[model samples]
Target: MNTYLHSVSLDREKCTGCTTCLRHCPTEAIRVKDGCAVINPDRCIDCGECIRVCPQKAKHVVCSKFSDMEKFKWRIALPAPTLYGQFEELDDIDYCLQGLLDMGFDEVYEVSQAAEIVSEYTRLLLKTEGIKKPVISSACPVIARLIALRFPYLKDNLLPLLPPMEIAAKKAVERALKEHPELKREDIGVCFISPCPAKASYVKNGFGDYKSNVDLVVSISDIYFQLINSMKREITPVPFSRSGVIGISWATSGGEATAIFNDKYLAADGIENVIKMLDQIENGMIPQLEFIELNACTGGCVGGVMTVENPFIAKARLQTLRRYLPVSQNFLDENERYVPTDCFFGEVPHYKPISRLSNNIGESMRMMADIQRLREELPGTDCGSCGAPTCRAFAEDVVKGQASLDACIIKTARSKCEGCKNNNEG
Candidate 1:
């Protein structure tokens, strides 16, 4: 059994056992059992979709508090590029970066700089490598996990590179050690300001065999108010910005593909749309495409559940911020040699086909026949009143012995009506 540290969780007290999250979950990781929502850790990609759709606000993402910064002698804050999108009418990105310092972080580093470096390496890899067509971006941890869980066949297509957050953490620690000779390596903590719970889970359980460089994961929503208050009282903004327009544009959809200047690439946002594209890729329908950028959230990081602003509004702010940036001096410089060669991806664990009816081939065949019979008996309406996403899913659950046929409200109502008619005839 593969166990992962998931950041998304449910508070049973606040849960009304509503099926809202069940229908919205892209991977079908959620199920309502015993009048409460249960999350299957193996199937969960931690995209934070459940958090977004939960009506009772029972779903929450586990994140580090401001007090966690006190553990280390030197704390460094690594803010995601999407942080700039949360504030409306903000002209300079420096004000938001400075807010982290005001919020007790000793130093602040932009993850966008690392994004630029990763973009450079990705372009080079695409040019030299002959691995496969439609190289998928591994920048989004949720998408990487989704591939591991549901689209295991596409695992080889995942980009073999560390995400920008990890690179930024590594760079931040290295810079801190070099500038402050007295500080021990253990004394420094690299914390990430995350836009989603998937990134928080990645910080806890790193991708593949690599250990995470980041020590803490802070949700953008957790400190949004504090940062806003801090920005209001900003005395002087930072003199210079480290990231360029290409790097900062990564907050919105299609930004990565645009940054790499890939002409035959497809940029997909939203988990459902990504699944559809992956299905096509699996069927070899898009062999002509060179790359596919998939973000689990609808509008990239701006659509993350932890973000404060609406996705469309945030995307607009990001575009405005991008236009304000000067043309990048090192957009696609061939001579730039700052790429991190040590960064490499390891094999992702294969997911078990849990939806399989049975372990034995003969039993599975029989179960499939039984499931078809049961499906025919039940109403086709996918009202989700039975706590399953669809009528077909409910039938599957019944065959698997996870649910009863009586759990279907439509069936129960019809049975009650039949009983009344029989009594009248008697």
Candidate 2:
């Protein structure tokens, strides 16, 4: 589908032509040219790695602003579990919810409710199907896209369930109508307090049979900070029931495993650790762990690049939150399980996403030929020093007319030696 073009963007003003982001990019999507960094949309997985590493703040997530919600008659705030960890003294969930209402929302829903529902649902999946050993969590859209890109073989292993946020969004719409029959479907707008840009994109672009359930996405760092300052003046904490310590903890890695499995599981946060585990699983070295929970962010949702506070601070805040809430029963009532299955999961994708070179056999062959020609002229050093993510990417850069093949140390060395030999012959 060549959907990557919609995945990333670069601000020329913020980029200093430094190769720092290129070196860290996992997909080899970024390249420096004419003192600016440009992203190849087809290559980007929309992982937000560059968003986290950019020094000039040149990189920004394309998401809806708070004012975008003004059109809806009834506004709903769908906060991510990470939202629980954002504030230092969010004694009650109601304060945050009320703050949203004060800002303009009519109602607020906890994304963790859906997280709980899916957690319990997944536990049943583990016991029933016996289909596959390591069922990947579909909560992180970036991780899901990465699997589609780098690990297509594991696609079948993803539990046949929508992400928690989607589940919550559906439940919110249903509950909203039930509580307020006067509210029209069009009248209500749902805005997710997003922890990353990927979620915003997920809602904008349907993924794996999913439609746009969320109407808007407000970055957590943006909304919560404003609420915190708002809280100082009011001094009145809005009281609401808690979703329990485990649900609050779900903001961190392995929180889901704790909510479901008591022990004998692996919770991997951070891309590096998750990649190692995926590699082990692919190589048939998957340990005896019952399940693996992977979050691409460093410290689960709280560590998302879009966050303002450091993840460590968020983790500490989340732990203290546990002191106030009771350990409620993990299972949801049967009525709560009545999800709008139609809205959650639909038709499966027929074609798996393939690499550009592999998309067309004839084109691939020509690209291979061109790559070979560039390789002969390319510097063989493989130093990501040229700001193209890799040596092969540098070759592709040359082929694309964005880079010179002589930029490679090895290629330059060989060119110099050839010149010396010619001089000797003369």
Candidate 1 per-residue lDDT over residues 1-426, each given as its tens digit: 657899999999999988899999988888888789988787889999999999999999998986788999999999999999889888888888888888888888789988887888788788865766678999999888888777778898899889889888988998999999999989998989889999999888877888899999988888899889888544778655688887887888898888777788889999899889888888887759778899999989999998888989988988888887864524545566445566776666556654566679999998889889989988999888888888888888898898999999999999999999999999
Provide the lowest-lDDT 10-residue window in model 1: 329-338
What is candidate 2's lDDT per residue for 146-247, written digit by digit as tens? 777777777776666787788778878999999999999899899999888888777877676668678888888777666775554466755664477666
Q: What would the TM-score be for candidate 1 when compared with the true structure? A: 0.92
Candidate 1 lDDT for residue 8: 95
Model 1, position 330, has a per-residue lDDT of 43
Candidate 2: regions farther than 4 A off? 4-8, 232-238, 334-340, 347-356, 360-380, 396-404, 407-410
TM-scores across all candidates? Answer: 0.92, 0.89
* Cα-based lDDT at residue 77, candidate 2: 89
Clashing pairs in 2: 4-41, 14-58, 379-411
